[model samples]
Target: MTALLSFWPLFRRQIGRLGLTLLLSVLTLAAGVALLWVSGWFLTAAALTTAGVSFNLFGPSSLIRGLSLVRILSRYGEKLIGHDATLRLLSTLRSWLFGRLFPRVPLAGRDLRHGDLVSRLTADVDTLDTVFLTAFGPLLTAALIGAGMAAGLFMLLPAAGPIYAATLILALIGVPALLLWLSRRIGAELVEASAALRILTLDRIDGHADLVAFGAMAESDRDFEAATRRLARARRGLGRAGTLAALAVQALAGMALIGTLWCGITALRHGEIDGPLLVGLLLAVLASFEATAMLVRSVGKFGAAATAAQRVRAIAQMRPAITDPKRPVALKQGDLAFNQVTFGFDPARPVLRELSLNLLSGERVAITGESGSGKSTLLALALRLHDPQVGSIEIGSTDIRTVSQADLHAHVALLSQNAPVFLGTLRDNLLIGRAEANDAELWSALEAARIADFVRALPDGLDAFVGEAGRTLSAGQARRLCLARVLLSPAAVLVFDEPTAGLDRETELDFLGDLAAATRGRSVILATHAQIPPGAVDKVYELADGRLSSRPSMRG
Candidate 1:
């Protein structure tokens, strides 16, 4: 119920459109009921008449034709309006969910898998189509049709009208309440099983290479089969519940029909009611039953859509851990400072302990440390990826936390280990840093990164495809391409994390020398464990035992 209510605001915004659709749907339903009643009345009236059933075909034919036209037109109008309104509502909902999700993604604590997030965005949002198409439409139609049936029954046979109304109320209210209770547990279980299957399938696909190498393909298949079987069992339970609910509704409709007929016969024998009016009442009762059945099916679909809505809401409501200050500070020369910073990815396990450092403008500093010694972590702080628990990171005399992430990145360029290589031409990837860079500027940056000859060697030159993640390129070439990206950017600060990793000594030194020369007038922080090239950096800082210490030049 709470989850259903959450969708009302968006629904209310489109109420005018929904109301128009509902009016058309109701008119269509009413026309069908009237046609059935009038046709039955005419056939019975002619049979009982002494004129041998050949009196007025024109009147009955006209009514039938008009009813048919109304039914078709109303149904067409209803579908057009209903689908248009639903699409608009869905668009609004997806926009709202995306707006809420963007800020939370950088800080969401849950280890959300990429595949799971994709499922939420695509599959989960799509499931909500049933909420409007099935649930809201049928519910509104049932209410209007049930009300009209009750009023028409009273006009025909006053004694039985109350009984018919009570029966309908019970079916509409009591049956749904009972079914909701029973299916709540089953629905929740099915949803969980479905999510588990998604996660397992995605994991298997992502780790396919590893599984094949280890000969664990059969084991993975068994696990997936188990998940599928669990989901099947849950679906079977849901089917059984639906069957039972349908049976209950049908039984109630039978009782209502029988009771109405019995009362009608008594009234007719007592000379208190006519045959035509009783027949009309009976037809309306059956039509109401049809509407009730649709309502039940709609409710079941709503249950499924409600489960999906909850998952989307959970993701859309998460708050980001880091947000720009209301009044953001602008960065200038990129002089960075870390003041007594003590931080950790997890609170109990500290990565940097009261660590502090400072970098002057136009200086090239190389940070070297053992694995897990917080070298990359320090660079992350400079980039403001995570805020420290107790201390501050400042850029050009302003705390980075006081600046927006966009502003921070605008002034600083970071080329981390395993830099992302998108699938596109070499020029496409290089121009990502500076979108307006011309052919000359691109070749210049590529040459400066020591990869111009390699780029020229390709048949298409700058137009050559790098393939996915640059899989076609060698490790050193990929690294140089990433460096070219950073070099092309106009940022004041450049931080390279292991830029020379996985390269030969000569190639590593040449790239380092080129990078240092390219950013001669800017602040550059090179976080690497490789030996620094002679005269490549203004200073060298080694991080050991969770502290930064200056190292004497080995070349001197």
Candidate 2:
């Protein structure tokens, strides 16, 4: 219920469009009922006139023709207006939800299932359309059409009006309520099972390289197939409830039509209404019930909509792992420091213990450590990806916890290990570091990273497709591309985490040699397990056993 209410703000913003949409729906249903009623009366009157019961031929014919035209025009208008409104509504809804969740999504998703998160953003969010199309619109139109029919019948025949109104009203409320209850559990089960299926499928596709390395691709395939089979079964389970509810709703509508016919016959015999009038009333009642009958199918799926809402709301409301201080201190130095910092991804196994280091302006420092020895954690601490549980990290004189994330990032930029390459042109990936950087600056950064010639060699150059995660480029080329991207940043300090992790020995040394010329006046910290030769950096620190020790040479 709370998840459903969160949309009230989005609803308020679109009130005008939704109102027009509902009004058009009411108008469309009203026209259908009106046309049916007018045609029935006209046919009956024309038949009596042929038998010498005086009636104006022109008036009846004109009434029938006019109602038919209104019905056709309104039906077309209703479809156009309703669909336009729905499309606009869905776009606004997706944009609004994405904007709310994008900021914290990176860290918030660290503990979340990747496939489920995608499902939430894509499939689950789409499920909400049922709330609008099936639940909200149909329920409102059913009530409006029902009330209008009841009011008209009351003026036509007092006794027959209550009888027909009561019968139709019961079917509208009772049938939907029963269907909703029966399918509630099935709806939730299907949504959950589908989300699980999406997660397993995505995991297999995304971890293709790792699965092949470990020869587990067959296992991954089997897991995906199992999930698919389960989802099919859950869908079949929900269909059973839907099928039963459909039959029940049709039976109710049939009974209401039969009752209307019986009521009209009794009313006509008692001199309460003429033959044409009686025929008109029975036809109107029959057509009006159609509006409510469509709602039975939608109400059964309400549980799934509610469950999807809960998932989306939970993600949107997740607190960020890092947040800005209420009053941030000035951040104006290329110098970085960590003072006896202690931290961990988990409390029982701390990654950094009393770690301390300092890199002043124009200095190049290298920290070499074995795998899983907290090399990346040091960069994360300096960037304030997460605050340390004990001690403090500082930029200049202010503790980093006192500096806003924006300020910290403006001073320090990290070219991370296995940096993700998005699916876009070469220019789009580089723009992430500095959105406003021009072509000349981009060329300069690429030249510094020793990849300018490679890019210029391509037919489309910067406009060429990079493919998903830079699948078009070799591992060495992708790293250089990422390095070029980082160089485009205006941050005073450049941090590189294993930027050449998988490169050949000679190429890694050559890349390291180029770093000095590229970052002449700024601070640089390169965290890696690889050996850095003399002159590539002014100082080297070995990070092992959760401590940093100064080294005089490239020796371990």
Candidate 3:
């Protein structure tokens, strides 16, 4: 019930379009009933003439032709209006769901796989088309058509009217309610099965290299097969539920037909109703059951669509662990300070404890320590990726938490140990740091990073395509490309976290010299455990057991 209710707001927002569609559907059904009643009248006129009764009310051919034309026109209008409204409603829903997902992305990022998230946003949301086309449209049309049939029957034969009404009410209302209850259980199982299958498929693709390297390809295939089997079982259960609901509707229609026949026969004997009226009543009763059967199928479709809606709602409702301040302060020159700051990715296990540091403008500071000594954590704090639980970090004169993240990042540029190499041309990647830079500027940045010669050696020069995750380039080449990107940013402060971690000795020295030359007048913070180059830095800080202290230059 709760899952079904969540779609109400989405439905209400599109009520204008839905209402128009509903009106057209009602008109279509009314025309169909009028045609059926008129055809019966024409048949009765022919019968009376054969029996020598002089009752020529009207021409049978004209009435039948006119009703048929009206029915065809109404059906065409219904198709045109209903489909137009459905498409407009679908577009609105897609936009709303995307807006809701964007703000909560960071919070949900860690918990969801990339492939699975993409599937839910696209394939899962598309399932709601069934709700619009089959459920909402058919359900409304059935109700209106059933009511009209009952009223017409009453005017023709009083006792037959109540019986037809009761049968319709039970088929359209009672049977659907019971089927929906059963569908809820089936829907839940299907949701779980599909989610598991999506995750497993993504995992297999991402871990393909690992599985092959460890000779576990067979095991991986087995797991994927298990997930597929579970999904198939759940789908079969939902199909079975649909079949049962259909059978129940058919049984009710048969019973209604039997009761209507019995009453029509009694009326014929007493001369209360003529033979033509009885035939018309029987035809109307049978035709009305078609709408009831459509209603039953629609209820089952709604149940399946409700499952998809719940998953989408869960993603939309997540609150980010980090949120921008209501009123953010602007950042200027980058003079960073950490005052007794402490933090942890997990609260129970601290990564940094009461750390304090300060760096002035244009000062090249080196942070060196053993592995797991909170080197990367300090850089993350400076970038404001995560907030400190205990103290404060300030860039220039403003606290980081008081300023917008974009403003804070504009003052600082970071090139981490695992620098992300996006899939693009050399020129494309460099332009990310400074979008307005021309070709001349891109070549200049590449030359400064000591990789211009290598880039020019390629067949396409700056336009060469780097495959996914820069797979086409070596680790050293990829690292230099990242450095070239940061160099083009021209920020006041630069932080390099183990930038030369996996480079060859010759490449490392050349890159270090280029970095030292490019960052002469800028504030530079290098976090590394490698031996520091002489004349490359102005000051050095070594961290031990969460405590930081200044150290003498290696040159001395």
Candidate 4:
């Protein structure tokens, strides 16, 4: 419940739409109750009146028709408006969640699986639709209708009013409270089990080949069966709890009806109220309980919604590893420098110690090192993906930390070792590099990356749809496609980690040979284990033992 409140600000944005939906829901319920009440009174009076005795049929008949029409129209409007507003709210939530998620990428120390994250973003968000659409609106409408019915009973049959109100109050509050308390643990378990099943399914799908190769298909099947069983058990428990709560509500409704009937009959014996009005009140009471029925059905879902809300809010509450400065300094064109920078995943064992280097504007420098020698870590620091433990990185003589991360990123772009070619058309993926780039610019970047001829040969050309992670293309082609995206970025400094990876030796040398011409006028930081050809870069350095030493360009 508290978790649901955290999203109140986002909910408040749709107040006007939600308010109208709520009003229509109330109208729908009210009309239904009134329609039932009028119908009962009209039929009873018509039957009791003597033949040809002056009895008004036109008024009661007219009200029944009007209420029936109102119920239909208002029910339609409620469904239409409620669904529209709920969908719009969900869309906004996804966008808001993604906006927060981006800055927290490489979420250090949070061992969140990809499949689990997907579940949170998609299934969990969908569960929240019940929060307002089903649970909140129905509960409030039930209360309103119940209160109205109680007030009318008090005015007409004073003896039954208190009894009806008390029973209704118990049905509305006590039943749901009991349901929530009973279902709370099981509901949370149900959500976890569902997410676990999803995660396992995704994992098996992704690792199908490995499982087959290792002859572990039987083991995987057993694991999957276990997860399914857990999910089934949790679902069964929640269902039982919901069933009990619904029964409790029905029991309370029975009590209210029987008590009202007894009080009305007693009043009739004393010449207090007539049969026609008594029948009408009894029918209205039954119809009014319809609202509580809807609420009971939706309350079962509220438990799950609360669990989903907690999962979603957990992610939203995480503090981002990086944030922009309050008063950011504008970056200017100058040398990129690392001044006595030191960092480590565990501070006691530093990956880079007192690392200091400088790359002048427009200079191409290559850093070669063995695996785990902090090459990628150093590049990450330069991009401010993670701040240094003990020192400052400066661009143009200003501390990089002093400038906004967005400004710093605009000045620098990176193509990491495992860079992805997202699932989209060639043009769509390239647009991510520079949304405003013209076709000519895209073509030029593709050509520079040595993949332009391949795309041109395809029937769709730039419009060719690349499968997920560029699965449709060969590994070498996919790497080149990602390289093209980095090349398309409008930045002064271009950083590549294993830029020529996946290419054949000959092609690797060719690309490296043309590196100077390909990235002309931009500062380049290349980290790789590949040999650097002569004149490919302005300087070469070897990284070993968390420090750099100047080295001559190596011959391929």
Best by lDDT: 4
Instruction: Please give, for residues 1-556, the per-residue lDDT of candidate 2 as tens digits.
Output: 5687777787666677777778877887888898889888888877777655466778767876886787677767767766776677678778977887766745632667878888998887788754776777888888899889888887987666776676666667876777667666777777888999888878777888899999998888888788888778777866777777667766766765666667767778888779988788778887888887766666766778878888888888888778788998888674688889888878577788888888888888998988899888888888888788888987776798888888888889988877888899999999998999999999999998889999999999998899999999988789889988888999888898998788898878877778877877888899977778667778898888888999885432
lDDT of each: 0.83, 0.80, 0.80, 0.89
* Candidate number of the best TM-score: 4
- The TM-scores, one per candidate, come to 0.81, 0.88, 0.75, 0.89
Check candidate 2 and list the clashing pairs. none
Please report how far candidate 3 places residue 9 from its true position, in Å. Answer: 3.6
Model 1: weakest 10-residue lDDT segment is 105-114
lDDT sort, best first: 4, 1, 2, 3
- Per-residue error (Å), model 3, residue 181: 1.0
Better of 1 and 3 by TM-score: 1
RMSD of each: 4.6, 3.3, 5.5, 3.1
Cα deviation at 33, candidate 4, in Å, is: 1.4
| Whole-model alpha-carbon lDDT for candidate 4 | 0.89
Per-residue lDDT, model 3, residue 116, is 64
Can you write out model 3's per-residue Cα lDDT over 1-556, one digit (the tens) per residue? 5765777777777677677777766776666666676677567656766654665556656776876787778777767776776676678778888888765644522677776687677756776744766887788788889888888777877777778888888888888888888887787777767877888888888888999999999998898899899889877887888788889888877877778778878888989888877777777677777777888877877666787878777777777556789998787676788998888777666677888888899888899999998898789788877788898998776898988877777788999988888888878899999999999999988887778999999999999999889999988789889998998986888999999898888777766766777777888899987777776778899977776889996552
| Clash count, candidate 1 | 0
lDDT, candidate 1, at 46:
65
Q: Which ten residues in a row have the lowest lDDT in candidate 4?
A: 547-556
TM-score quality measure for candidate 1: 0.81
